[model samples]
Target: MNNPAPGASAPPPAPAARRTIDIVNASLKRRYAREARFRFMGAAAVFLGLLFVGVLFGDIVAKGYTAFAQTYIQVPVYFDSATLDPDGSRDPQVLANADYLGLVKASLRTLFPQVTGRAQQRALYALISAGAPQQLQTMVRQYPSVLGTTRDVWLIAGADVDMLVKGQIDRELPEADRRIKDSTLTLVDQLKTEGRIEQRFNTGFFTNGTSREPELAGIAGALAGTFYTLALTLLLSFPIGVGAALYLQEFAPKNRWTDLIEVNINNLAAVPSIVFGLLGLAVFINVFGVPRSTPLVGALVLALMTLPTIIIASRAALQSVPPSIREAALGVGASPLQTQFHHVLPLALPGIMTGAIIGMARALGESAPLLMIGMIAFIVDIPQGITDSATVLPVQIYLWADSPERGFVERTSAAILVLLGFMVVMNLAAVLLRRRFERRW
Candidate 1:
């Protein structure tokens, strides 16, 4: 209140501005703290997501890597000419139907003469694969000269013995709980010590077909079926989807009908995949009389399921082409068709292909749709053509996962690894193709 000495420095203005500055500084500090907490939470979230992905992949690899190798046992077989060719005719049919299993049993007896009781003998014989006879038949057919020789042939071990060799079976379990008894364990140990048991890279797992026996089961048939189904699905979906999208996006009248179609396509993309399966079952099978469980039927189903996705993606890709490009093309004396085909489509091709590949990848992993078409039937033969009854890889995995055998467990995981590899390859192809096409223009 004192006006004395007006030039006496205005009494320092009560330091009022300092209070406002302090309040602002405190608020800024709190804001900075909140920002740091938010950043920490985001980093933690990203790390948690990555950690979960790593654990899932690691577990799958741990369980599946063991299936790459198969166990085998060496059996000294006296290829009794009387057993292989009882009449010595060496006829193909005669050799085909011979009791090759008897020869395997006789060899097992020679290896372990101590096993006398029929039940004990059966348990000992259980060590070798049931495919041993078929193996012998194949070998004899390949080399007729080996028919009379006594040779030490390495044969696939039974699933149980393979499990025991791989340490999957617990030896400490009681006889009632264990799949194999102490007697079988002793025999397996003896074979192990004698250097007769061997583990080798399993080529058959990639080459053979479905089997009731786990040891003989492989992914070959499923791989073939998957290839055929996907090829046909691509053939059916790509052209049709692209044409439909081209018409609707570039040429079609903007009427209510086209709008309804656009809306329905968007909705179809959201439909459950199983509904497509039911449609295939009713339409492709019931109305058209297409054979069930064939790759042809599966392809039809997958093509239908993938159509909406392809249409949507294609339309988006077409729309992404700049309107200036179309204007320039038309201004340069190009027709509407010429502008779209010669300029717009080529530019949008990479996106279109990327979408197509994504749809195919989805089809590759689908089972419910194929299952509705009866692709779940246990077809043992490798399908040679599209019309042949077949089951794709996903269905094969489903079947194996449902199996009770411990051996099938590993095979199932291994099959999953294969499926994932295929998916990776497909996605990589899409990326590579996109880059390639992008550079073309």
Candidate 2:
């Protein structure tokens, strides 16, 4: 190197080169350790979340699994002509009017002859469902020739007795502490020993409607209401959402009015669901005079709530289509409408459907809006149409959760399982549709 002049400053020292891997610096080691710790923390958080989900599902399955089966008793019913059909005509009307309650009580009395006092007899009769009369009526109508005959018939047990037989109500507890009395337990055990009581698949739980009696209650009405509401929601939301998205993304001028509308839609999507319920109450029920608790009102309300979500999703989907597609279509002399309908819309449909599914799923689980419109009421009859009195699955769950009966606890869990099942199916369908139709650019 040449020497510097007296007035000139010496060149600055050169920077140190990076050390080899064989001699790593302490700073590098610290950095690697920090990165490793961060990764572990992230993994731990994810594991904890999954573990919580597993615990929840396991608990629900444990509780609700028993609700799928019911206890039934085989009673020797003597269809005496005097009690069932005094006229001997076996007319269905006569059968409907007959005292089937007397026949059921008589059968139970014969089964336990030792119980004689009025109180004992009352307790014994309480083991069977009060709805047994209706069940007997159905049996008689199905086979009118069975009149004046003695035959064994399977009848449903009462909810308390059902719980005892299902092993839900503990026998070890003191008689006063338990819902089932010692006498009732003895009779249940005797019946079980004789193979007269058995657990069978509970078809009534699916086929019937809400009842004050838990054993007689079912989810058919709520299930039907959910279907009707969803049908209406999809019918109203999909086309309108898609149309609005197409216009805003492709056809509408970029102006303040359009910007304001976009902002409002975004804000609406974030609004609490109950707010929409209140809106529906004011507009559809109070102003338009639509019937309360009807699926029509429910769908209209859900449509308003779901509209913003669908519009946002559809706009995003429409925007994602490559500009090259539009250009190519227009280059071939296709008009704006033709370009959108024939080219862009077809490619964008998969994403649009995914958004629709999400919106529908959100609507399916919403109960607050429906509650505002009176859908939380107990509806015993399966709705024959959208305008009929009805409740949805979420509302059914809410009602059951509020019930004081021990049986409704299991029912509430079962309803939750059912609602989750529906959501899973909807999401799966969306995924399948996307995979089937999505094209690689």
- List per-prediction Cα lDDT, in the order shown: 0.92, 0.90
Instruction: Give me the runs in candidate 1 sitting further than 4 Å from their true place.
Output: 1-25, 439-441
**Per-residue lDDT for 24-115 in model 2, tens only?**
44356678999999999999999999999999999998899888998899999988988777778777888888889988999999888888
Question: In candidate 1, which residue pairs clash?
Answer: none
Candidate 1: tens digits of C-alpha lDDT, residues 332-402: 89999999999999999999999999999999999998889999999889999999999999999999999
Candidate 2 local Cα displacement, residue 51, angstroms:
1.0
Models 1 onward score TM values of 0.94, 0.95
